[model samples]
Every structure is written in C-alpha cells, then in structure tokens.
Target: KEEERLRNVDVIRRNGRALGQIIDDILDLSKVEAGKISIEHIDFDLSELLGDIFLLFSRKAQEKGIQFSIESTTSVPSRLVSDPTRIRQILINMVSNALKFTHEGSLRVIFHWKYETTDQFPRSGLLTFQIIDTGVGINDVHQERLFQPFTQAEDSIARQFGGTGLGLVLSRQLAKLLGGNVDLEWSEPGKGSCFRVTIEAVDSAESSQSVPHFLLSETKSASSEDEIVMTLDGIRILLAEDAPDNQLLITHILESSGAEVEVVGNGRDAVDHALAGRYHLVLMDVQMPILSGHEASQELRSRGYCGPIVALTAHAMVEERQRSHDLGYDDYLTKPIDSLKLIQTIRLHAKDQDDVKRENFVATKFSSIDSLS
Candidate 1:
C-alpha cells in the first residue's frame, strides 16, 4: 500500500511538471505571435554550450540503449555572440524531438560554421546545427503541417508520444527571432530525419582563447535527482504574493536555503512590512490587490528604500520584463519559479551585514573627501 501510494505521488508530480511546461510553452508561443519576443546577443563559449547539451541528452540516450554523439568542426569558433538561451532552446527542442521518435538507432548533433567578412563585423559567420536522428521518419503530407501551431505530423503521433506539438513551432519562431530558421533538410519514411538550424553569430574578440574554468562554474549538468544545496545564512527576504500556494512555495524554497522569508498577502501590506522591517531583498509579485507590484515598487523607491526589489510575474513577454525594470524592479522573474533560479537571485541581490558595512564605509569615505574638497 505504501509503495502504491508513493507511485501515485510520483505520477502526480510528473504530471504537474508536464502541465507547467505546457503552460510555459503556450506563454512563449503567445509572446512570439504578439511580436513581443526579443533576442539577446551575448558572448558565449560554443563548446561549453554543446558540452552541456551532450551531458543533458547523453544519459537519456544511454537509458534507451541508443548511441548519441556531438561533433564540431575546427573552423567553428569557440566563442560567438548570439542569443545563447534561444539557441539552446531550439537545439534542445530539436534533440528532444529526435530522441522521442528514435527508439533504436543512433542520434548525432553536427556543428558547422561558415565565416564571412562584412563591413559591420570583421568576423561574422553563420552557425548551423544539424540534428540527425535515426527515427520513425515523417511522410511528406505530415511534414507540411509540422510547423503549424499545436500540430503534429500525424494524430497517432500525439497519442503515442504525448506532446502538445508546440515545440517545433516555438523552435522555428525563436530561430527566426535570432535571425535564423529551422528546416528539415531531408527525411525518408521508416528511415531517419535531419533538422538544420542556422543562425547568425559574430566571433567574439576572445574567440581564440579558451574560456576560463571558473567562468563555466555555473554551467552544470541538469539532474532531477539531486537537490540543490546552498547556504543563504543571515539573509532576510520579503515575499509579496497574494496566492497562498505561491507564498508557501517561495517561502519553503528560500527557507531551505537558510534564508529568512516574510510573506505578505498584498502590496499594501508588503510596503508597510518592508518599510517597518529590515530586509536584504524583496520578491514582489507583479499583480497584487490594493496596489500592484509595480506601483508598490515605485512607492518603495519614492520612499527611499534602497534594497533590491525583484519582480515575480506570470507574464513572460519581453515588454513585461522591460516594464518591471522601468518600474523600479531590480530584477524580473517569471513564474512558475525554478527553485535554483530563485535561490540564485536571492544570493545575488541579498546584502549581508558585511556588505552593508562596506557600502556604508565607502559612502562615508567619499562624503568626507567631498566635504574636505
């Protein structure tokens, strides 16, 4: 009976996570459709990113008794400036789709790059990723509808695979946002498929040099079984959330990291409590009763509160993130919050006693110098 109960609980947890992912994908699709999605260009090590992907999918391939490998050419620059997040998303989608369809044979990810000298960028190139999978290939008729929203090649695929069919649509949209596109190079029924994703990337100034090990410290492989252990000792967090479930969830996650969390039901109470108490950081839910998170943050700033205020919202739109910054939020986080991200945000923004004393000392020293001058 206990084992059965545990199994049921596991099923519930898995289903909840699936539902959460579906909701997040739908939000992303809506943002893309509304022309609100934005791309970010930042220097990233291509090798490190591909290594992380290999770590993520290799285990799954092993579990299924299938071979998985990633190969990159020497000409492909190690460092490139592009939207790493979107690129990772697209590649993950492609690889995941490939793995799902593939039961037996091997899967490979080939990275190829072609450099071009342009007036704007001396070192620019097209980075292409080919996800080749030996899977149950799609027919021509099914391939036509692959990019359609909420669609699959065949209805039976959904029944067997259990997917909402938003991955391909989002992948293509995101690739286009990054100045690229995803295409099916070739596929034969009962044989295999190859998906090619091409994006524009400029070689960073430091592309020739290797990325420091310390710089990749945070780039760890994703593991569901391991619990994140981090100490946020002597940190105090103000959590402004109207939802009881969110309040509990955030409080538990923060508490587990050894941080003190005080929950407020509304923005009004949040402002009052925040003013009355000393907090290292504030996690403000964007939409709250009486006063919204934005209004509350503005009020706090107006009242001369200098602590970091991070906006927490369900809105994943780029404009919503920009508005949070415009409204005095130190940072923005979209919900349902990943515990690791929440803890990392707190650790990044929370100021301990030593930090406070140092800042105060610096201010005093600067003010004394100014007075003397």
Candidate 2:
C-alpha cells in the first residue's frame, strides 16, 4: 500500500509538471503573437541537449514498439551560440507532433550544417534540424496553413489528436527568430513527412559550459540511496500573491524543491514583510490589491533592496514585462507557474549578485508565414 501510494504521488507530480508546461507553451504562443517573446542567445552544448531529448523519448518509442534514433554529422559543432531553449522546444514540438500521427513506425532525427553567408553575420552556418517520421503525412492542401497559429491539418485530425495546434506554429516562429525558417522537404499521403528547419549558428570553442538546470541526469550513480537527488535546500523564498488558489499552487511548487517559503496576500504586505525579513528571492505576482507588483518592486528598489525579485505575469504582454524590468524585478514567469521552470528561474536569479538579466528582446524582421510561400 505504501509503495502504491508513492507511485501515485510520482505519477501526479509528473502529470502536473506536464500540464504546467502545456500552459506555459500556450502563453508563449500568445507572447509570440504579441511580439513579446525574446530570443535568448546563450552558449550551450547543442549535441548534449539532443542526446537528452533522445533519452527522454526512448521509453515512449519502446512502449509503442516504434523505432527511434538520432544522427548528426561531425560538421555540426559540439557547442553552439544561440537560444538553446527555443531550439530544444522546436525539436520537441516536431517530434511530439510526429508521434501523434504515427501509430506503428519509425522516427529519426538528423542534424547537420550548411555553409551560408548572411548580410549581418558572414561566417555563420545554417544548422539544419531534420525530423523524418513514418507518420500519416500532411496532405498538400492542408499544408498551406500548417504553421498558422491555432491551426491543425483538419477538423477530423484535430478531434482525433486533441491539440491547440500551436506547436508547429511556435516552432516555425522560433526558428525564424533565430534567422532561419522551416521548410517542407518532402511528403506523401501514405509514405511519410520530412520537415527541415534551418537556423543561423556559430560554433563555440569552449566545451564545458553551463547547461539548463532541468536538463539533469536521470539518476545519481555516485550518491547513496537515501540521498536527495535535487533540491533548493537552505533557500528562503517570499511569495507575494493575492489569489488563494495561485498562492497554494505556487507554495506547493516551491516547497517541493526544498525551499522554505512564506506568503503574503497583497503587494503592500510584500513590501513590508520583505523589508522586515531576509529572503534569497521573491516571487511577486504582478497584479495585487492596494499596490501592484510593479509598485511594490519600485518601493523595494527605492529602499535599496538589491536581492533577486521575479514577477509572476498573467498577460505575457510586452508592456507588463517591460514594467517588471523597469520597476526592478530581475526576471519573470507567466502565471499557472511551471514547476521546473519556476525552480530553475529561482536558482538562476538566486546566484546573481550582479545585474545580469535575460538579454534584451531582439525582434526579427522576417515572418514565419513568409517562409511558407
């Protein structure tokens, strides 16, 4: 009974985390549509990210009795300078979409680079991310609006698949933002589909570098059985949220990461409590009664509170994010907070004693739809 209970807990945890990611993705689509999504150019191991992704889907493929594999040419660098998060998301979206259409078949991921010279960056390569899947291929008629926001192939397919159809759209937009585009390589109704994305990239000379915190090892081989795998141990967090449901949800998310958290219902109390106590970070909800999150952050900043404070945004609008930055919040996360990303953001900002925030938002000139025609 005890073992069953533990298994149930783990299942719920996994499902909750997955649902949170879906919500976060939907909000990201909204931001993209509003031209608020920022492309972050950070150096990361591109190959390692793909390896981890393959490991993640390996089990799913086994369950379905489908073959899955990954391949990359040596010309594709080990490390790259670009937005690793967006790139990974694009791959995941494509692969997941492929899996949905495929019943019993094979999935293969191929990566390589093409020599390219652009106006702004002459010595750049167009990294090709090719996803080939033996799935129910996209018909040419339906492919016209394949990358349109809130679109799917057909209503019958939408009902069967049950998706908002944002994945491919977001993937295309993200690739274009990185100065590349998604191209349909080949497809047939019965054969399969091959979708390729080309994005600008430059090789990084360094090998060992920072990785995404959530991209962690599956198991700790060196540690003892009783040892905790991961945690936010000894971290004190202050949460300023007025809504009861969100307060409960956020507290649970933070506490699960081994953080000691205290909550306040309004922004005024947030300012008061934060001033009187010590905390490593603050999760400030942007909208609160009596005083807004931006106002509270302003007050704390005016009083010389230099600690990391992250805003919990709902709208995912440019103005809201800008206000958060202008009013002294170091970073932000949209509401219905993703547990993994919440912890990662806290860990990221917690280590910052300096004023290093996400890179400035860079808007690309080309549109994702433009690449279709």
Candidate 3:
C-alpha cells in the first residue's frame, strides 16, 4: 500500500494541479463578488510587470501567428506605486480574450498618454493602454453589456469564446482597484475590438536594484534521491487536514524531507496549534468541523499570522479558490493532494529563507552538492 501510494504521486500531482488552478480562479471571483477583494499598493516597475505578462502570453500569440506588441510613449511613467498583480491580471484577461476571438488579424498593445488639456502637459500623465485585435468585434448593442458581471454578448459568443464572461468585469473592477477604469473605445463587428484603460501615473523614481526573476520552473522530474536532497529540510510546516489517511500521507512526505510536521484535525485545532507553534508554513483545509477553514484563516489573519497560510480544499472551483484568498489565505490547494506541489507551494513562500540557507550551505563544506548532477 505504501509503495502504491508513492507510485501514484505522479497522477495525483497532475490531477491536483489542474484542480488547484480551477479552485484559484473560482476563489478569485468569489472574493470579487463578495466585495472582499483587497489591493496592496507597492512601488513596482511597469516594464517588468508588462514583460512578465507578455512573456506569459507570447507562446499563445505565436501559436496564432498574431502580432503582440507593447508600446510606451515618452510621457508614460516607467515606475509607479500600484497594484502590480491586479494590473497584470487585467492585462492577461484582456489579451487572452482578444486572442481567442481574433483568428485572422494582428493583436497590438499600445501604451501612451491620454492628454487632459492641449496646453497643460501635466507631470503625471494619464497612462492609457489600448488592446486592438483583428478579429470578430462586438456590436454597438452588446458593447454596453460586455463589462457586466456574468453576461457576455451572446450565448453563442460566450460558448464559442469559452470563458465565464467574468474577465472584462473583473478587469474593470481591478482597474477600479488601481484607481482607474476600463472603457470601450471602439469596436466594429467582424473587424476587431479596442479597449482603452486609463490610469494615473506618478513620476518615475530611480529604479530599485532589480531583484532576480522568480523562477517558476517545472518540477515534474526528479529521482527520489534528488527530491529528498532538495525538499524542505528546515522549515516547520503546520498541516491542518481532517482526513486521517491524508494527514498520514502528507506527514510521511514532509517528514521524509526532514521538515518538522505538525498535524491537526480541524480548523479550531489548527489555529490553536498554529498560535502555539513556531511554524514556517500552514497547510489549511478549507472545510473542517468546529470552525471552517475560512473562519480559522480569518482568525489567524486578525491575530497577525504573518507566515504563509496555504488553503487546502476538496472543492476545486473558481468560487472556492477566490473565497480562500478573500479569507486571507496566501495560496491554495485541493484534495488528493500532490505531495510535491504541497512542498512546492510551501517552498515558494519560504523561498527567501531557503535561499539564505542554500547560499550558506553552498559557501560551507557542503558546497560539493551545489554542482551535483
């Protein structure tokens, strides 16, 4: 049974990841629906965020042979204090929709200044982004309803385009979060659509030292020896799973990697353990008796649990995922969990600490492991 469970990890991991993404998307929407959405404003490089978004969708654009361009005018601010993640989300949803409906023509992204007055060239320019795609465009009648929460242009278009029709709505809401709004500039049916996003920009400060890119590398392959060597070795993980079998499985996986694992059966117990323990990470199950995972997470957040709390759930849907984040969970997971992904998420949040330990380990007598093949 033990060997069978270990061997099934691959299939379990694959299924869990797909479910996880679906859950994340749902949870995001739920948060928005409940007005539980919160934005964190931070100084971020606009170019870096754009570059990441473009890189993410570059492959899709190439597959369609559609032109994807990013244009910034001289007046545009390169740096700004804003919600970078929300901005990226808005861009990705817009671009994805454009590509989906666009079959024959090019897709262009233009970033320029939206002038307020002819002579008043303000220091803070209205940063406007226009996504123009050569594809089937919306009619004048449907344009008004496009940004409405759940309704798309038509049932056929909604089915054909393949989306929950929440993208545009969410994008607009996100724009509002960033102190701006999304407006339909122009659209001609069977031609294309143009979306105009205008946001206020502040003067760019001297760029902060660029941090190294976060490597979101594939972790699909690794021998047990290799995996054991690189897995969480020092981080203490507090796992709140009610299922006895799941708890045992996860505990085995974490302990094998030399991580200190503490398990609880319910949200209330989880909270109690989390407060009492010096944990580096929390794997919280969303549905638990005595107190729901959301309730527990809220309690922890209120008490200032600064460490990462990754939500776990059997409910793999967009609404569920959104609710997890809305409740202040840092990340999420789904049932029949992938031990590797669980570790991966735990690692993602613990990366800063991991990097320091790795560097020091490399600098010391254990440096030989750095170049291990």
Candidate 4:
C-alpha cells in the first residue's frame, strides 16, 4: 500500500507539474485582471528582500557554474513601503531565465537608482530597478511579444528550457500593479539582456521599513536570538488538497507556522471536515476529482460552514477567482505556494473569520429576540 501510494504520488507529481504551469499563467492573469493585487506600502528592507532573492537564485546559478552577481546602489533605500514579494518574484524569474539560457559566462544583476521621466506621463520622475544579465539575449523581432502571456522567444527556447513563458508576463503585470513597468532595455544575441523595472519612489518617511523588528528584545543577547522562536505557534488549520505531494508540502509549511493541520484530499471532503471539525480556517483546493472546490464550497454554504475558506489553485485568472469568491470562498492563494504569502493569507483570513463570527453571532442573537414577537 505504501509503494502504491508512492506510485500514485509520482503520477500526481507529473500531472501537477504540467497543470501547475498552466495554473501559474491563469493565476497571474487572474490577479491582474481581477485587480486583486494592490500596492501595499509597508516598511521593509529593500536590501534584505534583494539579498533573499540573491540567495534564492545563487543556487541555480551555481548549478550551471554561471557567476551570479548583485550590485546595489548606495542610494537604494534600505527600508521602503512597497511590495517586496512581487519584486523578488520578478527578479527571480528574470534571473532564472537568464541562467537557463546562458550556457557560458557570468550573469550580473546591478541595481542603481535612476530618476527618469516617461513619455507616457511627462514630468513624472521614477526610480528604476535594473536587472542586467550576461546570457542568451532575446532577438529584436520577439521583443514585443516577450511580455505577452505564455509566449517565449521561440518554440525552441521553450523546448530547450522547460518553462511556461508566463514569467515575463507575470513580472510585467506585477510591475504595473505597483504603478511601474518592466522594460527590456537591451537584448543582444550571444551577449545578454537588460530589463529595467521602474516605480514611483516612496519618500524616506514612507520608506522607514524594518525587517521583523518586533522579535528583538531590550534585554536579549545574540545567544537568546537563536533560542527565541521566530515562527507563529499553535495555529489550527484545515488544508484541502487532492494531490498527496502538494498536501505534504502545504502541511510542512503550515507546520513551520507552528500550526496543527488536518488535511483532506478534495473539496467535498474539505467542506465535510470543515463543517464537522473544529478548525481555525480552511485551505480549499479549487480543482479536485471527487468534487470541485467551488461545488464543495457551495455545499459548505448551504450547510452553514461559515469559517474562512481560502481557495488554493494553479489558475491565476480573474474570472476563476471571482467565481471562487462568488462561491463563498473567503480568500485565494495561487500556486507555486509562496511560504510567506501563505502565512500572511492565514493571518488575514483568521482575522476576517473572527470578524465574521462576531457579526454572525450578534445577528443570530438579535433574530432570537425578534422571534419572541
């Protein structure tokens, strides 16, 4: 049975891999199309975010023996109120693609603050984040279509390097979401490529971002810092997933949050468990074999399963997301499952569920009094 389960998991992995790519394109388009993404101005370290990104891509670069370099300007804001996650995503995709295409030589990523005006809106000075890579640069003719959804430079590139071609499109969409744009400055064949992302700068006052500063203590030494737990603790969660590997991955992530997770393999099972079990919230996987997440959620609604149900899917399109909401899902998560984002989603939805329960309880109590009449 264990071997059979493993074989089934392997098949799901293969299927999920292909479907995952398709889902990525859908989710990216969905987020952009639904206007779900918003520019959140919160204090955070730009360098730390960039460093995290660099650390992430460094492994990939080393695998190919291609030197990956990151140079930041002295003027670059150490702290800023901007969406760092999306920024990281854009760079990772770019760097990953660069590393994939470049068979030889080094890939360098330089960051400098450039105050420039765009032709679209005159007199608007913006700060640009530039990513320059020494790899197989794109050709002139395909440049226009580079940012188009699910389009690569050529079929050969897609075949050579297995990719969905959604990376550039999603990056561009994310840039636009932040009131910025991703532009290809130069792409010379056999040399490399440079992509510049420009965004409106937040003032220094607005940029007083810090990294997880609350954990620091006045009486603490560096030794205590290692002992102090940085993770969230004792979070109770209900996870809905059909794929066994995905379920395990989600379980691992939730566990890192110090969460107690109960897992189900389909949407109906999700709704059933949610209605019957005591859980803080539900992570609903939209596409499932037994019952679609949407249908299960509808059933949950009819059965009065009023806890938070966050839709998790590979599809990143607007209509699909709206449908998730319409079907009574409280929140949405797109795959390749961002770890920090999953935690953030949990925090937000947990708060939302509290608010909802309070409201519902008050309404129910009031209705009981009205019944006396």
Candidate 5:
C-alpha cells in the first residue's frame, strides 16, 4: 500500500508538471502573437548549454534503448552572445518531437557556426543546429501542416502521442524572433527526419577557442545526478501570502530544504513579524489583504529592515519585474514556482553568518601576508 501510494504521488507530480508546461506554452504563444516577447543578448557558455541538453535527453534515450549524441561538426565558439533561454526552449521542443516520434534507432544533434561580418555586430555568425532522428517520419500531406498551431501530423498521432501540437509553432516563432528560422531539412516516411534551426549569434570577445566534439556516450560515466545540491539549513524565512494553497506549497518547498518558514496571510502580519523577529529572508506575495505586498515592503524598507525581500507574483512580464525592482524588492519570482530556482534565489540572498566570518578571516589573513611581503 505504501509503494502504491508513492507511485500515485509520482503520477500526480508528473501530471502537475505537464499541466504547468501547457499553461506556460500558451502564455508564451500569446506573448509572441501580441509582440510582447523580448529577446536578450548576453554572453553565455555554449559548451555548458549543450551539455545541459545532452544531460536532459541522454537518460531518456538510454531508457528507450536508443543511442543519443551531440557533436560539434565544425569550429564552434566556446561562448556566444544570444538569448540562452529561448535557444534552449527551441532546441528542447525539436528534440522532444524527435524523441516522441522515434521509437527505435538513434537520435543525434549536430551544431556548428559560420562567421559573418556585419555592421551592427562585428563578430556575428549563423549558428545552426540539426536534430536528426530515425523515427516514424512525416509524409508530404502531414508535413505541410506541421507548423500550424494545434495541428499534429495526423489525428492518430495526436491520440497516441498526447501533445498540444504547439511546440513547432512556438519554436518557429521564437526562432524568428531571435533572427533565425526553423526548417525541416528532409523527412522520409518510416525512415527518419532532420530538423535544422539557425539563429544569429555574436561571438563573445573572450571566446577565441573552439569547442571540441562532445559525445553523450563519453559522458555516461559522469552522472547527471551529480548536480549542485542547494540547502537552506537553519535559515529563517517570513512568508506573506494570502492564498492558502500557495502558502502551503511555498512552506513545503522551503521546509524540505531545512528552512524555518513562518507563514502570514496578510501583509500587515508579515510586516509585524518581520520587524519583531530576525529572518534571513522575506517572500512577499504581491496581492494581500490589510496591506499590499508593495506597501508592506515599502514600510519595511522605510523602517530599515535590511534583510532581502523577494516579490512573488503570477505576472511574468518584463514591466512587472521592473516594477518589483523599483519597489525595492531584492528579487522577483513567478507563481507555480520552480523549486530549484526558488532555493537558489533564497540561498543567494540569505548568506550564512559563519561562512561570511570565515571569508572575512581569510581576506584579513591574505591582506596581512601581502603587507609582510
């Protein structure tokens, strides 16, 4: 009975995650259509990004008894200035589709780049990715409508595969937004398909070296499970949330990471508790009774409460984030919170006093040595 209960819980969690993804996809599509989507160009490690994708799909491929690999066919920069989030999203959608249709054989991702001199960006280039999969390939009739919203290859594929059929639509739109495009290079029914995604990227000033071939099979020994573990042991947090479900959810997430969480339903109580007690961090929900989160945060800041106060809201717009920052919030997080990100945010703001003291001591000793030298 215990084992059965655990399995049921796992199923529920999986379904919840799937539902969340669907909602996020819908919101993203709406933003794209409304011209509200924004693209950011920042220098990020290309190798790290590809490694994350490899780690994500390699295990699934292993489970399905299919080979998976990612290789840089040509000289690829180690870093690039592009929107990593959108890039990952587009690649994930394509790879997910490939995996969904492919029941047997192998899946491979090949990426490379060609430098081009442009007026706006001196070190710009077209970075292309090709996801090749041996799957139940699409025919001509179905291929034509593949990029349409809510339209899959066929009705039977929709029934059997269970998807919203928005992946391709979103992928193409996002790629275009990044000054690139997504295309089906080739497909043969009952054979395989190759998806090509090309996007403009500015080579980072520091990335002069090219990345070497990276193979999934070679990285099998390096456990993807060896991820950085985040903990908030012995930290105190004040949570200001009106919704009972959100309060419960947030509390559970924090307590599981060894944090001491005190929940208050109103902003007034939050202010009172935070002022009276010493808390490492405060999670203030934007909407509440008695006083709004913004009002309470402003009040706290006025009263010289120096601890970090993070805003929580359902709004994921850039204006909303800017408003939170302008209102003196240390950070902003959207609803249906990602647990890992939440933990990371808290850890970043709530520093351990012992660690701080140790760091200070080390710095002092180093300074003394420098003086002697």
Candidate 6:
C-alpha cells in the first residue's frame, strides 16, 4: 500500500508537470506572436547547454522507443556568447516535434560551426544545428503552411497527435529574434524530416578569466576565498503545504538538495515557525487552512522575516501573481513543481542577488551541503 501510494503521488506530480509545461509553452508562444519575447545575449557554457538538451530529449525518446544522440563535426567551444534560453527553446521545440512523430529508428542532433581564429577571442561564427529524425515526414503540399500560427499539416493529424501547433512558428520567430533563422531543411512523406537553424556565436572568456565566489558551509573552512559564502547544507527550511502528497514530494525534493526541511499544514503554523525558527528558505503553498500563503507571507514580512520565500501555486492569472508579489513573496513558481527549477530558484534567491552574478562560482560549494543533511 505504501509503495502504491508513492506511485500514485509520482503520477500526480508528473501529470501536473506536463500541464504546467503546456501552459508555459502557450504563454511563450503568445509572447512571440505579440512581439514581446525578450532575447538575452549572455555568456553560458555551450557544452553544458547542449548536454542538458541531450539529456532532456534522450529520456523522452527512450520512453517512446526512439534512439537519440548528439554529434558534433568540430570541437564546440565550452563558453559561447548567445541567449541560452532561446537556443534551448528552439532545440526543445524541435526535439518535441521529432519525438512526437518518430516511433522507431533514431533522432540525432548535429552541431557544426565555421569560425575564424583571432589573437584574443574566436570571432563570430555561423553555428548550424541540424535535427534529423526518422519520423512521419510532412508532404510538400501541406508543408507550405507548416509554420503558420494556428494550423497544422492536417486536421486529422492534429486530432491524432495533440499539440498547440504554435511550436514551429514560435521556433522560427525566436530564432530570428536571436539573429538566426530556422528552416525545414528537407522532408519527404513517410521518410523523415530535417530541421536546421543557423546562429552567430562568439567565444566568451569570462569563466576562464575570473576568480569566483562559492557557497561555504557553516563548519568547513574555505580552500580559497571564493568558496566562503553560506552553503545550502544544514540550512533550515519551512515548508507550508496542506496536501500530504505534495508535502512528501516537496520534502523529498528539497532534502535531495541538502536542505533540512520542516513541514506545516496551515499558514498559521508557517508564520509561527518562521517567527521562532531561523530558516534560510520557505516554500509556501498559496491555499491553506486558517490563512492563505499571501497572508502568511505578509505576516512574515511584517515581522521582518527577510529570508527567501517562494510561492507554489497552480494559478497563472496575472492578478494572482501580482497579488502574491505585492504580498511580499520573493518569487513565484507554478505547480506541479519542476524539481530542477525549484532547486535553481532556491539557490538563486537564498543568497544576495549580487552574489549570484559572480560568473565563476561553482556548484560544488552547495553539493557538500548534502553531506551535512
């Protein structure tokens, strides 16, 4: 019975995550259509980004009996200048489409770039991403309107395979916004499809050239001055959740990241705990007995509890988010919760905002915190 209960909880969490992703995707596509999407050019690890993409789609493809792999023609630089979010968005869309159509065989992503070497940094180069999949390819006659906002290849296809159908359109708009372009390189009915994107990239040396600061544990001395901040390990966390399943899932997730968590059933307990305890973070669910998360947060702030407080809610309404923000919540996250984003948000908002900007801080400082927990 215990095992079955845990399995049911996992199923609920997964379905919540899927629904959350669909909502997020719709909002992103709408932003694209309204020409309000922002493209940020920031320095990020190229290898790390691609590796994450590979890991994400690899699991999905595996679940559907499709082989997935990433290949590179040349040595991709470790650090590159580009908008990781948009690049990731494009890759994610292509991979989702590939997985949706492909039943068997393999899905492969190839990275090829042409660069010019300079004395200091690698000059801007054309980076080509080719996604090849052995799937039910679209016919030429229907391919003309493939990138339109509200249309798919056929009505029957949309019924058989469910989607918002704005994925390809949003991908094109995002690629162009990033000074790149997306094209259906080649496709033949019953064979497969090849989608390609070309973008410009320059090498970034900030990571290679900086001395970084890192989170430090309360006990251990730092090896270098950089790793001397507060670590996540041993930090007390108060989780205000009414649902037993969510409490279990969230506790497991936070504990996995080395945080010591305490659970409370109502907003009243949450406020009482926050006032008496020295928690480093709080995961507050919005709807609770006695008082809502908003009320609890307002009370906490009123009592000068300045720690990072994040809201877990299913509502995506603008007024709901603004109300939470106005009520002194530090950050808001929609449910079912995304474990990775949850960790990142905690780590990000736990420390001072300026502290997170140091490009060289490694995550190992926090990993050791797990041992303490």
Q: Candidate 2 vs candidate 5: which has greater lDDT?
A: 5
- Stretches of candidate 6 off by over 4 Å are 1-20, 116-122, 207-245, 252-261, 264-332, 336-373
Top candidate on lDDT is 5
Residue 238 of candidate 3: its Cα lDDT? 85
Q: After superposition, how far is residue 208 of candidate 3 from its true place, in Å?
A: 8.7
lDDT of 3 by residue, 88-156 (tens): 777877887888898765777777654343343343446677888898999988888897766888879
Ranking by TM-score: 5, 1, 2, 6, 4, 3
- Prediction 6 global C-alpha lDDT: 0.72
lDDT of 4 by residue, 222-244 (tens): 23323322243655788888999
Best-fitting candidate, measured by TM-score?
A: 5
Candidate 4: residue 341 Cα off by (Å): 7.4
Between candidates 3 and 4, name the one with more favorable TM-score. 4
Q: Rank the candidates by lDDT, best first.
A: 5, 1, 2, 6, 3, 4
Q: Candidate 3: lDDT over CA atoms? A: 0.68
The sequence of per-residue lDDT tens digits that candidate 1 reaches over residues 83-158 is: 7767877888899899999988788888777887799998888989888989999999899998998888999998
User: What would the per-residue lDDT of candidate 2 be over residues 1-373, giving only the tens digit for each residue?
Assistant: 9999999999888767656656766877787778877777666667566764665566566666567777765356667777776787788788888877877778887777665757765656778878898888888898887877778888888777767678888888889999998878888887789999888886665753423322222222223344323356667888999999998998997788788899999999999988888777789998999999989989988997766788888766656666667777777887667665677566554444232222221111211111110
Tell me which residue pairs clash in candidate 6.
216-229
Please, what are the lDDT tens digits per residue for candidate 6 over residues 1-373? 9999999999887667666666777877776677665556666666656755665555456556666777776655667777776787788888888878888777888877678566665566677889898999999898998888768888888787767578888788888887789999999888899999887777675544311111111222223334322235655678999999999998998787677889999999999987787666789999999998989999988987776678889975545556676787766777878886676557645543334333222222211110110
TM-score of each: 0.69, 0.65, 0.55, 0.57, 0.73, 0.65
Q: Which stretches of candidate 3 lie over 4 Å from their true place?
A: 1-30, 113-125, 204-373
